[model samples]
Target: MEKKPFFQGLTKKTIALALAVILWAFTNFELDVERDVRIPLHLSGLPEDLIIVNNAPENVDLSLRGARNLLSSFAFSNKSIPVDLQKTERGVLKIDLKRAASQIVPRGIDIVAARPSKLSLNIDMLVTKRFKVKPVLGEPDSGYEISKKLKIVPQFVKVKGPASQLGKLESIETAKIKLEGEKAEFTAPVQLQLPSQYMEVLEGDHVNVTVYIKEIILSKEFRDVDIVPRNFGELEYTTTPELKATLVFNGPYKTINDLTSNDVKVFIDGAEMGESRVKRLRVKVQYPNSDLLKLTKTSPTSVRVRVKPPPPEESPET
Candidate 1:
């Protein structure tokens, strides 16, 4: 019986295999390596009374140095840097990003360097403010008008946002409501338009808006309206002044805009004249659609009329 040597069968092939394994270990596990890894930045512990107004980095780049295997595993792992803002106050805050990077680093891996070693943050106080709700509207049909007094169910709304931003806000407008071809009053539910991205509607997000629509009223002046003499016989007669009148008409927009001087008439009634050679005659006006149209004013409301005396031609002819 014989005892086998501890290094029995140590051939050239075996020696080469051992060396290859050792080199792989040094390259992957024992030797130190550097790598740049990007990890998410988690923000927590922020005071409820404060808000961040500036653009903050969502992820930070970390230069890590450690064994190749460890760093590779850590880089691929789901890990984030947790930032605690429990002691933060309203204003600009400078943060040490290196400290944050070191906190979440694994036990073996070392943080060689961190991009953006510091962060400049803009903070503001959280506040609630009330603002008037302005209703937005589109153009109505032609010859129609919308009332100036818009009825909103909740006239005012309360919003919570950064104090600095809220200071510049005047009024919040509602989602645009179209009044195109609208002929009558209507009520609709409308969403509000937030002025700032950081603002949240705490009281009223949607409101009921009552829009009033009516036919537009307009005034038109008809110049140089003819004033004719009515019931005047063949006898010669003359008026104190050239018979011309001006009229101002008030009515619906469509009717007034379409009306013309020909649609109206003015006349002096000679039948109502007295025996006086010279007499004052009152002028009268007439027009179609009087129910919807009204004659607001008439220039030269009265005129003087004279009857010419006939010549004594009968005695001369005889």
Candidate 2:
């Protein structure tokens, strides 16, 4: 094997050239540089009753000046600017972005400028209010109806929001409830529909709603209902012009629609009437299913009745 020298192919001029290039690169790397860093904007120290509104900036763009090496490392670090609102009042608030960012930057880095030098915020006081919960209901089945007033478990709800918006809110409604083809009573848990995007429900966001449903009540009129006499045995009793009645009944839709004159009776009682030249008696009505049907009205409320003694039949029979 041939012996090789440690300084083989080396020269004094080559050494000087390498040293010059190294120094130039080190100087350039250490030179001051400018860059734009995008960092999050943090809001802190706000009073519990106060809130910032109206499109506040969420992140800030900082124009930072530092050494080339330092700027590169800082871009990856966790950097943010926090704005203190402890003493803020309800109104428009303005803050300087450069001044806010300078507090968090590294000691050697300078925040020369910011994209948005000034920030504007709309501040408002927070308020909580209780409002009635309105239920949004849909139509029921074709032959059904709402039987009575609706029942809500919790009639009122509390909402928190900016005072400017909450002042205009009068009530809150539940998410729409579909009752189409619903025939029976039911209970449901429904969420609330907020009127404003900034409002939040406190304690609970939903309520229990109870709905009542029943068959619809319908009215039907029956014409020419015969009026009969009762308890007039062995006596001739005639109504002065043969009275007939018009009867109106109210019941469930199915029962009322299927009703006929045979289902109802109109009569006059002779036992209740006293002996007089011309007896005036009030008409009465009888229904088999009293629990389901009701008589609402009857025409010819009263009728004149004449009673005659039975013809002399005792002599002929003897």
Candidate 3:
């Protein structure tokens, strides 16, 4: 073997080499540092649905650890790493380090800051209301039937946002709640998908809507019979919802449609019918003008008329 001193010197050189390599690695590597960030004020980029009343971690502390050269040049004041409020809403927006990063940041540095150092975003006032929702349809495949009726859970909901945006928002709707004429039920979120520039919707993610479907039936018939005045004396001419009596009919659906309401009529006979009394009764049908499904049945198929006696000869001359 070679002399011991020679090996010892070689061993020392080897150790030095390893330490130099390790130091180089540390110089190349970066450590996370906490940075304090501050935003001047709310900007115009925020969404209408969200009111960024406060900034999260108002004063953000980001941890950055990187090459000494890079760290030496890094300064929190150099650039504006804004707290993007355009997409934020009235609710709390947690700090997102992924975006807090800037071009100056190197790969080695890490982000380590207070969970929420500063902020008291005061979201503006928002008001929501109930609105009518209409459904639209697209061409559907053959043979399937869709339910025409739509059921809105809670029927309505409230939407709150900036007054300006709220005014333009005539409605909050979904992506066409369509069943494609498949004759089934449909449920989805009431996604108020606004343009990118628009504010984020802080309301619940989805709305509850229900639709029922049933096969169409074509076997019913209907008819209209003349309406007769009822208790006319009891009603003053000015009274609203004038009361009327009419003959109610029930029979073959086809036959009912074949007859007209005018064809059925109620008339009074002059056979010395007593006052406050009526006798002539008949059924007359006439042309129809409405689509009230069917007049399945009528109440008081008949009526008893009472006539008030002539006022006793006006009280003797004053």
The number of the candidate with the highest TM-score is 1
Question: What ranges in model 2 sit over 4 Å off?
Answer: 1-27, 30-36, 63-66, 107-118, 221-318
- For residues 199-295, could you state the per-residue lDDT of candidate 1 as single tens digits? 9999758999999999999999877878999998876788866788989989988988988888788999888776777888898999988999988
State every prediction's TM-score relative to the real structure: 0.78, 0.64, 0.30
Model 1 earns a TM-score of: 0.78
Ranked candidates (TM-score, high to low): 1, 2, 3
Off by over 4 Å in 1: 1-11, 30-36, 112-117, 136-148, 168-170, 175-184, 213-216, 231-236, 269-282, 302-318
Q: Record all residue pairs in model 1 with backbone atoms less than 3 Å apart, i.e. clashing.
A: none
What is the C-alpha local distance difference test score of candidate 2? 0.84
lDDT of 1: 0.87
RMSD of each: 4.4, 6.2, 18.6
